[model samples]
Target: MGVRLRTAMLAAALLVAGFALRAPFDQLRRYLIARCNDPVRLPRLAEESRVRFQPGARDCAARVAEMLPAALARIEQEQGRPFANPPTVAVYVSYEDYARAGGLGDASVAAVARSGYVLLSPTLCGDESERLAGVLAHELSHSHIFGWRRSWFAARPPSWFTEGLAVMVSGGGGAEGVDEAMAVRAMARGWAITIEDTGLWRDFGAIGFAAEPPPEIFGGDRFAGRQRLAYREAQMFVAWLRRIDPQGFARLLNRVENNESFKDSFVKIYGAGSSRRWSEFLAGVSR
Candidate 1:
């Protein structure tokens, strides 16, 4: 009888130990999933980090899935080949969260390819739903064009070209016009930022070449002044390219994606060095 009692107690103790070990793991798994789906926590992880989903994120995901095929079709029409992979998009509703994630709502951001996602805020949704679709279409074009490459490449294309192409592809004509008018006025006032100075968009913190101290424009109420200028000038340059040779612009973009040297591609399409053509183009616009 004592032996039977000992056997029963040993079995009970083992069962209890097994559950004790599994309990923590079960709790940890739940915690991990909760964090993954937490809209607020995920955005705070890192700058330019991709959060796969947020609470109430399914709506934006569904909207993107619905709109992306058509946008891809347009891109294929221009490039003559399908994109390498479909992009991953993340949508957030909080402006604070959006800024924390290193994003601006005035434009959608496309990280070069590895797990590319879109960050959307309520401000971008606005009254019309189609506007959101347009924004997604624009950012997705960047994803498609860049093809999942990170910013580590030494010979990457410039911000002006990438951003200009995105604006051109997303059909952002009105914004381009508004920026051009503003730029013309700013230039007249002797306040125009130089292109060399504007190249700051390539870096994370310092997005322009001005002497002003780095501003916390991402989290604050205002837009980053230099970033705003870069986007505007990029749009105008692309719009100019479209006006000059629509088909050539399309071919040039395709060539860019194919890893063609920028100078070679420019000479082939525009019949001269890009630097020369860009200077002439800027001068014409300024006049």
Candidate 2:
């Protein structure tokens, strides 16, 4: 074979290897750091439930333990189903350890639902217990979907639906910085992110915030400003659907859990296309 062809083949192989190894690499790093953690068990959580933090972070851990049951209950109550297999919760005592986990791009995130874990930052756990509970519920909502689908190969839901549902079911956990009234006003003025169809790589975080939120929203925190606005907008959309047709919202969750096409499921449950539903939601919020 030509030298050039051999080099091309080698590059392709390396690319594939990198893609396969990235997840395991990050998990291993997180596991190593967790070795020093002190575990806090909650019998009310799922079978594999693990909540742990560094030795000196007991106060934060205790607060998490106290709020955990209520958090899990809130998601189950709102979604009408229990977690198939809840993700383990890992608490970091500081931002340094949280950033070393490697998957998330932004360090401002209070907590994130990973493939099989929820990593919490110190800032989140240090906040008021109520806020911690809300954030915990929001992350668990993602974990519920992760487990119910059973595998990463299952149908990928759109970011709008996933994050929107999380914020809605968690009672505005991720959208705390952006209120419903403000989000509605922004949507009415045509400053909203486009609701796109589900695709493998269509995460909102990856896409970045397209909607221009007001300059004064989160003060100097651009990340929080844009992120919370998108989250609030999506939450409003989902909340509207839930209020308009409770049965349909329930069916939507069922279909989503079963790895069904989201767009098709919306149409089947709502008796109209997703586009129509979007228009209806916008009209109601605007009025």
Report the lDDT tens digits of candidate 1 across residue range 1-287. Answer: 69999999999999999987785665455445434544444432222233343565555555655665677788666555677675556666554555445332223332212234445554444433556655666667667766734344525656666666665676762132235677565544444333331233224222232233235522352243445555566667667776899888778776667766655777788888756666776678677
lDDT of 1 at 87: 56
Off by over 4 Å in 1: 1-52, 78-80, 93-114, 119-131, 148-154, 173-179, 190-226
* Global CA lDDT computed for model 2: 0.73
TM-score of 2: 0.78
Residue 178 CA displacement from its true place in model 1, Å: 3.7
By summed lDDT, which 10 consecutive residues of candidate 1 come out lowest?
A: 105-114
Candidate 2 residue pairs in clash (backbone atoms < 3 Å): none
**Top of the candidates by lDDT:** 2
Model 1 TM-score, 2 decimals: 0.60
Give the true-structure RMSD of model 2.
5.1
Can you write out model 2's per-residue Cα lDDT over 188-224, one digit (the tens) per residue? 7778766765744323343234466667756898777
TM-score of each: 0.60, 0.78
Model 2 stretches with alpha carbons more than 4 Å out = 1-49, 127-130, 199-211, 214-217
